[model samples]
Target: MLRRIPSQLAVALFWLLHWLPLPLQAVIGESVGELLYRFASRRRHIVMVNLRLCLPELDVTERQRIARAHFRALGRSILERGLLWWASAERLKRMIRLEGAERLRALLDDGRPVMLLAPHFLGLDMGGARIAMEFNCVSIYARQKNAVFDHWLFHGRSRFGDQQLLSRQDGVRGTVKAMKAGRPFYYLPDMDYGREDSIFVPFFGVPAATITGLSRLSRLTRAAVVPCVTRMLPGGGGYVVELGEAWADFPTADVEADTTRMNRWIESVVRTMPEQYYWVHRRFKTRPPGEARPY
Candidate 1:
């Protein structure tokens, strides 16, 4: 009971922070992030390592700058989640701008199964919440270690529309059913889950153990692949949810080639917003056989 107090108090702090103006929150978040970059050495190291691996062309100084900026964006994301949890629907709609949404709506209106390819961006949750407001969607949910945080996280995500979140343990079976029922699956497939069911694909010219789930799911469900990327505007401007056009002739016979294409597209988008990408995650943690681990 005593151990839970800290998380409870942290939740309280988030609640308090939500009342402040967005620009003020951005300032506080950036200040907190700068401190994290200095003190959180382990995670800072991970961010640096990711940048070094993915953006090898950038000199050490430039990569360091981007790493520091990423921490700032990450901090803002954590603190601003309070707004998602507690703010009114009207307030949130003003903050999130959705572009190219007609492309998504056209498919959904036609009773087609659509897979929204959402990559790991700092503003992913914001984008997800915005999507929940407009459409019924299904996304994979991973349980957090802290039960208190987990409960609130789930509530905040599902508070808007008829949002259904399936656990990672439930696998894609349940998600497939939900999608077939006309729910767009908000998929995040850019992570180093493991060697199993993942093929070595080129991510930023590095051999990343990428998952083949995107191709498999699309093939299994006959869903159109639509790329959705959320960009966090600087200076507390808010987020832009960019829904890209559906990929034509996706999920080809060769799964490896399709997965490679997915990674390449994500890499191209990452280049556009290098700092906002989630660099703190150990994306290259898994390695091929007999190869040394980077982290």
Candidate 2:
């Protein structure tokens, strides 16, 4: 149909762009990001608001600098996703290096249920793609409004391994069932999904409405929470998927406390690479009773 032309063109462009060298792609992507930073007023405002709330110590100018840098990272991520979608398994493996992978393998070897606590980072898709190459994993994703784009997104992600993509609307029961069956869950729990099944937890000292699914999932499946942080190296340098040691004695009797601990750990990681974090998202959108929304 006529309405699908734009989406078709976008996919074609991504396919074309994937053929270029990474360094050249990085240059073009950053340039695109600079343009977005200047012209995309709404997204720029959201990023600024997030920076203002989360990194209050940074002055206006510093926050602006970080915001611009974040847009550049986001731009690179969008462009590089083409590589993830079409590049060969060998080529992708060469670019994405997994550090501390044994930690995850050890848990699985011990017949333990594993949950990969992947936060929102620019290289999230690349990291997930890399993991999918090695393990038959399960992840939850929201469907895109555009049917053309949605089909490609699902195809790109499911291209490698026996990866299973569950719709966000499918809920935790299906994901829990997957986790119980020895499939490692690539879980991204650091987003504001409103008040349902979420509690107000302090993220960067701000009360963020975070889903309590991490603790609940762990409790139900007895999964070990291993933090997976995917970092995009500067310029043409490839990505590194760093797997941290699994948390011991996690998901205690109190779900609130467990969620708080998860947020604190995510905050620490974001501090290390502020520009790569998903700043464009309205992280603090949902507010507690009597509190105003930040975005």
Candidate 3:
């Protein structure tokens, strides 16, 4: 009953936020996110540690500044979730300024399924919805956490012909099915799932456990794995979604080799804009034998 009550309240609050003007709603949302971050000291520490490791070249002062900005951005993202899920199609469209969309469209025109891989960046939810509207349907692999939140997010993502599949037992099969049906599916291969379904790879000179699902799916379905990112423009000018080159070939006979190569590709893309990447995640939590966790 407690869980059910919170879920109901969340739904009510979502609609309430949706009814407000976008700017006003964003202000409120960011404020709430900032409050949460202030209280969540453990999480803040984890984010700081992650940032420091990824940007070892930066001195303490520079790293702290980046971390503070990242937290603020995260707060904005949290508050914008309701607006993203419930806003009208036109409103959502206006919220972002897209780039390299033609690159994605061109890939789809080739009659092959495309795998869009991105690190957790700004306006991810909104950006995904926009892409699904412009291109074909997208199937995204989402990690299932709270049932209530999952239910809400699933419907929210699917509202624009984008399906959300849980990253569980049938996730791989479902993803492959979607790709074979010529749908563009999305996956974030930056985090550490575990040692079982992942392998150690170099990310910012540190070993990180990276998911191999993208490589496996591409090989099985013959889909094109393309690196993409949504970066926030300065002065709150909205977001720009950029597309990079597609993977020429993936999923060779050796899964480890293929996974490592794929992680390297992701690392290269992330290096270009380190601040945009989600430095809050403990990417090195699951290290190899006799190795300590970086964060």
* TM-scores for every candidate against the unseen true structure: 0.97, 0.97, 0.85
* TM-score, cand. 2: 0.97
Candidate with the larger lDDT of 2 and 3: 2
Tens digit per residue, CA lDDT, model 3, 102-171: 7777877787888888767766776777776676554555645778777777767778754555556665
Ranking by TM-score: 1, 2, 3
Candidate 3: lDDT of 210?
79
Q: Residue 163, candidate 2: how far off, in angstroms? A: 0.8
Q: For candidate 1, lDDT tens digit of each residue in 40-157? A: 8889999998999998999999999999999888889988989999999988889999888899999999989999999999999999999888899999999888998999999998
Q: What's the number of clashes in each of the models?
A: 0, 0, 0
lDDT of 2 by residue, 212-280 (tens): 988998998899999999999997788999999999999799999999999999999999999999998
Instruction: State each model's CA lDDT, in order.
Output: 0.91, 0.90, 0.71
User: Which ten contiguous residues of candidate 3 have the minimum total lDDT?
Assistant: 1-10
Model 2: residues with Cα > 4 Å off, grouped in runs: 1-5
In model 1, state the lDDT of residue 171. 79
Instruction: Give candidate 3's total backbone clashes.
Output: 0
Report residue 138 deviation for candidate 3 (angstroms): 4.2
